[model samples]
Target: MSVLDRIIRTTTADLGARMVRIPAAELEARALMAPRRPSFAAALCAPGLSVIAEHKRRSPSRGAIRVDLELTEIVRDYERGGAAAVSVLTEERHFGGALDDLTEAAWVCGLPLLRKDFVVDRYQLLEARAAGASAVLLIVAALPIRRLEELHGAALDLGLDVLVEVHDAVELDVARSIGARIVGVNNRDLRDFSIDVERTYRLLDGMPAGALVVAESGIRGVDDARRLAAAGVDAVLVGEALMAAPDPRLACEELACACG
Candidate 1:
């Protein structure tokens, strides 16, 4: 099986276990009680290229980028460095992250939090809201069009923004079909986990005009971020490079400044 297949299987298994522990009704109740989060979608559209710095512990491709840092500290560092938003990798098995990581980020920082996970079920959306996430990532390669539509609607209903991620023209059509306003173009190919920064350049012109374009993955530094900004990307989701930097706050400042 490909890496994407493995992620799907792992997510499926984890979903079952999570539901058994929290149950859907309880999760929804928690969401209903939590304070409303501001529009994470609007933050990306602010003038100049916005930065969505990521808090990722490990990945299938790269192991343990920053195992020593605390979520509260790292996310606060991102905020101090002028990140417009923060993406918390919550994929557990593959990414070595948890829902509590997002929760802690939200608790400690004022930046809008995006739950970066393979969302196959609505349960995850409720879980995210309960955990204080203001937005969630919906990968086109992970779910069928019908499922995507349902989850997209469900997330909006809960007052959470959905970053409808597309990898190609066909996926962009699916996003448009659901009226997705925030668009993320991932440079990494999910099937084989290969990355090419030019992938965003290739498909971006085809995206809907005025849709928030977020370039994800393979952001190495200020120069790479500047290239994306020049390409008209509204924001960039940088992970490994920032996480591994000797001074993450400085790294974020340099990247954001480069975008400007």
Candidate 2:
């Protein structure tokens, strides 16, 4: 099975256990109680190609990047450096992150906090809102069209913006059909965890003109950001490069400058 298939199976197993522990109504109640925060889509849609700085400790593809930095200090630095928004990786199995990371970042950083995770259920969406996430990621490769609509609707009802991610044309079509306003073209293929920065360009032509676009993965430098920006990408999601830097704050500043 592909890595994507494996994740689907694992997610199914986890979902069963998760449902037993936390009732969906309670989760929805928690989502409803939390104040609706500003969306990252609003933040990144501003003029230039914005930098969506991320807080990630590890990835299935790259392993550990920065296990040393504490969440408070890291988020504070990103905020200080003028990040358009902060993406907190909340995938525990693949990425060394937890839901608490989103809540902590939200409390510390004034920027919009996006809960970056494999959202396979509506429960996860409610969990994200309760954890203080302003936005959530919905990977097209993970969900069928029906499930995507259900989760997207749930997220919208909870006042959470969805960054629907698509690797190619078919997924983009589904996103558009489901009224996804913010579309992310991930250069990295989750199936085998392979990256090709040019993939965004290949898929850009088919994306709707008015949709907010984010170029994700393999974006390592000013030149890369500039290239994507030139192609009209609204923003970039960067993680590994920034986390690996000795001074992540300065690294973010440099990347932000590159986007300019």
Candidate whose lDDT is highest: 1
Candidate 2 local Cα displacement, residue 93, angstroms = 1.1
Q: What C-alpha lDDT does candidate 1 achieve relative to the native structure?
A: 0.90
Where does the lowest 10-residue lDDT sum fall in candidate 2?
A: 7-16
TM-score of every prediction relative to native: 0.98, 0.96
lDDT of 1 by residue, 1-260 (tens): 98999999999999999999988998899998999766688889888899999999998887778978888888988999989999999999999999888888878988888999999999999989998889999998899889999999999999999999988889988888888889999889888889988888998778886789999988888888878888888999999998999999999998888776
TM-score of 1: 0.98
Relative to the unseen true structure, what is the Cα RMSD of model 2?
A: 1.3
For model 2, residues 19-129, the per-residue Cα lDDT tens digits are 899898987788789876777788987778899998998988888888888989888888777689999998777788888888888787778889998889888888899
Each candidate: what lDDT?
Answer: 0.90, 0.87
What pairs collide in candidate 1?
A: none
Global Cα RMSD, each model: 1.0, 1.3
**Model 1, C-alpha of 198: deviation from truth (Å):** 0.3
Q: Which stretches of candidate 1 lie over 4 Å from their true place?
A: none
- Top candidate when judged by TM-score against the true structure: 1
